[model samples]
Target: MTCGYARAVERARAGSARVPLTRASAALRRWSQRSQVTLTAVLLLVAGLLTVGIAADPDWVPPATFLLLEVVAVFLLRLRPLAVLGGTVLVCAWGLWWWGAESITPGFLAVLTLSVVAIGVFARERQRLGLRGAPGDRMLVDLRDRLAAHGRVPPLPAGWRVDSEIRSAHAEGFSGDFMVAGTRAGGTTLEIVLVDVSGKGMGAGVRSLQLSGAFGGLLGALPREEFLGAANGYLLAQAWAEGFATAIHVVVDLRTGDFTVSSAGHPPAMQLHAGSGRMELLDTVGAPALGVVADLRCAALTGRLDQGDVLLLYTDGLIEARGGDLEQGIDRLMGAADRVLAPGRGSAAAVLAGVRAGDDDDRAVVLIQRA
Candidate 1:
C-alpha cells in the first residue's frame, strides 16, 4: 500500500509540474488558459452541432473524422505566425476541395473569410507596432532630428558682445516664428536675417531649422551680396522648396549707423525711435522669395540707426495675429520696450513678454540696441 501511494504521489506531482506557473507568471498563464478554454468550448459546440446534424444524413462522410481534423487544426493555432499561416492556408485549401464533393454552408464561408481577414489585419498591426521603419517611424525620427537642432548653436559671439534669450509658449514645437542672427563684423558692418519658414509642425519645423543653419553659416562667411545670393540659390535647390520661407537680410553699420536691408516675401521689420517711440516698417520691395527663383536679385537699401535707437525684427505671425487690432499690437510692443528697458536695464524681456501676452501666433523678437 505504501508503494502504491508513492506512485500516485509521483503522478500527481508530474501533472502539477506540467503547468509550471508561478505568481509572476500567473497573469499570462491565466490569460492563455482562458483563451484555450474558450476556444475548446467553441470547437466542442461546433463539433457537437455538426455531429448531430450529420447523424441523420445517410450520404455524408463520418462526422468523427471531420471533427478530428478540425480539432487538429485548432491545436495548430498556437504555432508561430508562419506556421499558423501555412496551416490555415492548407486548411482553407482542404475546405475548398471538400466543397467540390459536399455542400458548402454559408456559415463556413463567413468564418473562413473572417479568419483570414482577422489574421491579416492583426498581423499587419503587430508588425507595424513592432518594427522600426514605418512612415510614422520615419516621421518620428525626423521629429527627433528637428527638435535636437532647436535653438542649438554655439554660445554668444566670442570677440563681439551680445545679448539673447528664448521664450516659448509651446515647449515641444515651434510655430516657425523666430529671430535673425546678427553678428557685428568689424567696426561698421552688422549682419542679420529674420527668418520665417512656411508652416508649423514637424515638416515645416525641420525645414526651418535647416534654413536657419544654412543662413547662419552664410551670415558668418560670405559678403552681404554674395550671402544673399548663395542663400537664395541654396533654398531654390531644395527638393521640396515650395517658395515658402519669407525672410529679411540686413547689414548695419555701427559707426555711421547706416543699415542696408533686403526683403523676400517677409513682413517688414520695424524701427523704433528710442526717445519718441516712433515705429516705421522697413522697405518691403525686393525680389521674390528665396526658393521661388534661383537668379533673382535682392535690392539692398541703406538707412541710419542713430544712438538710443532700437531695431525691431519681427515675423508675420506677430503682425498677422488676429483677435486684436494690428496697430494696437505694434503700439503695445513699442510701449513695452520703453517700459521694461528702464534707464540702466535693456528691455529685451519686456519686448518678448509683451509679444507673448498680446499676439496669438508664434512670436519672435530681435531687439538691437546700441549701448
Candidate 2:
C-alpha cells in the first residue's frame, strides 16, 4: 500500500508539470499565429544585423551598423517602410559587395534561411487573414485612431450641449479638419475650437494633427483672449514651409452664459436669437490664419447667450460649395438653421447635415445652446 501511494503521488506531480507545459505551448502557438507581422519585422531586422556583422571588417565600424540600426528603427519605431527602404537597399548592396563569392558564416546563413521561412509564413498568413494594403496602412489606421481620440469632444457642463461632425475628403486615413470641446477644471467655463488646416490629403492631415495637439493643450488653459495668440505663436515657431490654418475659438461661462469668441481667418460663427427667431452672423474681425505672419493679433468678441439662444460655429468647408461662394453658403446655412433649430428640436449635426455642401473639402461644425 505504501509503494502504491508513492507511485500515485509521483504520477500526480508529473501530470501537473505537463499541464503547465501544455498551457505554455498553446500560448506560444497563439502568439505565433497572431504576431506574423511582428515576427517578420524582427526576422528581417535580425537578418540584416547578421549580414552586417559578417560582412563588415571586425576592426572597422561598418556603415552597415547604422543601416542595421535603421532597420531596427523602422521595425520598432513604426516608421514608414517606403520612406526608409532606400537605406536598407544600400546596406544590402554593401553586404553583397563585401561578401561576394565568400562563404557566409553558418549562423548568418541560418538566420537568412529563417528569414526566408518567416517571409513565406507571413505571406501565407497575411493572405489567409485577407490583410489589406501594406504595413504602412496598418500604421496609418493606428495614427487615425490616435488623432480621433485626441480630437474627441470632452464632457461639457450641465445645461449646455455641444455636437460636431467631420467628414474627410478621403475615404480612409485622417482628415484635415478637427474640433475640440471641453469644460475647464473649475467647471464654470467651457471652450470649443474648430480648425481646418490648409490643403488636403495626408500632408494636411499630419499638420492638422500637429495643430490639434497644440490647440488641445491650449484650450481652457489660457485666458480667453490669449489662447489664439498662443496658438499663433506656436504655429510661427513651427515655421511650416507653406501651410496655414484657420480656426474659431469660443469660451463660455457656464453660469452666466457670457461668452467670448475669436477667429483666425475662419468663417464667421452664427447666433440664433431665441426670441426674434433670427440668425445673426458673429463675424468678428481678427488676424490672418496661423503661420501667416509673426506676432499676429486676434480680436475676441464678447456676448451673452440668453436662455434658449443657440450658437453655431463652422469651418469654411460648410459654406464653400462648387458653384456657390461664401455669401451663398452662409445664406444656405442660416436658412437651414432657421428651419431645423427649434427649441429642443435639432442638433448641430442635424443642422450640418441639412446644409451639406457639394464640394469635397472637409467640414466641421459645432452647435452650442444654453438651457
Candidate 3:
C-alpha cells in the first residue's frame, strides 16, 4: 500500500512537470516563428564569419563586410527582405569575381539560400497578418483628408472679415465643434453656421463631421429662417437616441448690413456695438436642441451691423466649465473681447486664447466684423 501511494505521488509530480514542459515548448515555438527572419540573418552572418576565418587568404575581408552590411539592413535598418536579398546577391557576385570562388564556402552558399527562403516566408506571413499592406490605414487617411478639406472656412464676401478658432478637448486633429461660412445668392448674402455637437473626442467629432456636411448643404440652399428647422428635422430623422446639437446660424446682407440670427439651444452671441462700445447679447429666441423635439420652431432676431461692429459666435464650451459658474465665464469672455477688440488690435485667435475657460471641452469661436 505504501509503495502504491508513493507511485501515485510520483506520477502526479511527473504530470505537473510535463505540463510546464509543454508550455515552455509552446512559448519557444512562438518565439522562433516570430524571429525566423532575424535568425536567418544571424545565421548568414555567422556563416560568412566562419568562411572568412577558414580561408587561407590574408585579404579575405569581403565576406565579413557583406555580412556586416546585411546585419545592419536586416536587424537595425529594417529594410525589406526582398530588397536586401537583391543587394546581397549583387555583393556576393562581386565578391566571387574579385576574390575568386575559393573565398566563398559551401556553408555560406547554403545559409544564403536558406536566408532567401526564410525572407520569402516572412513576407508571406506578414501579408497574412495584415502588417505588410495598409488598406485600412489608407482608407482612414482618405477619410481624414476629405474631412480636413471640408472643415476649412468658406470664402467670405467683401466688406466682411471673418476669423475663427477651435480647440478640442482631446487635442486631436479634429474637434466636435465646426463652422461653415459661404456666400449665397450671387454673393449678396453671407450664411454662416457654427455648431457644437453633444459629447467630446472622436465620437462627437464624427457626429460633427456628418452634421457639417448636412448643414453646409442646408445653408447653401435653404432660406435663412428655414435653416435651423431643416437641420433639426434632419437630426431627428437619424433617430439618434442620446444625441443633440446646439447651433447658431447667421445670414448677413452685405449691401445693407442687415443680419438675421437664429439659435437652437445654443449660447447667445455677443455683438460689439461699434457706436456704443458696449457688448450685448443678441436676444434671439431659441428652440429645443436638434433631435430633442419633433415640432421645433426657431425664431430669428433681426439686427443691423454698422461699419466696424463685431459679432462673436461661439460654442457653449466657451461658457461651461467644470466646478465653475457659466455667468462668470460669459463675463470673462465679454471682458476679453472688450480688451482684445478695443481698437481691433487683436484677432479672434488672440481673444480665444485670452478668455479660454481652461477645461476639457471642445471650444469654437467665430468673429465676424463689418469692414
- Which candidate has the highest lDDT of all? 3
Clashing pairs in 1: none
Decreasing lDDT order of the candidates: 3, 2, 1
The digit string of per-residue lDDT tens for model 3 on 91-173 reads 55446645665656666666655665565565555445333322322333444454445446556666778888888885775
Candidate number with the higher lDDT (1 or 2): 2
- Predicted candidate 2: what Cα RMSD to the true structure? 18.4
Give the per-residue lDDT digits (tens) of candidate 2, residues 109-201: 455444434444544454444332244335455556656765566666667777777777744456888876667857778888888888876
CA displacement after TM-score superposition, residue 94 of candidate 1 (Å): 27
Instruction: Show where candidate 2 strays beyond 4 Å.
Output: 1-135
Best by TM-score: 2
Candidate 3, superposed: residue stretches over 4 Å from native: 1-138
The CA lDDT of each predicted structure is 0.54, 0.67, 0.69
Give per-residue CA lDDT, model 1, range 198-302, as digits (tens): 766545655665666556555646557666666666677565745467778777765666778888876566676656656666766567766777676877776
* Candidate 3 TM-score over all chains jointly: 0.63
* Quality of model 2 by C-alpha lDDT: 0.67
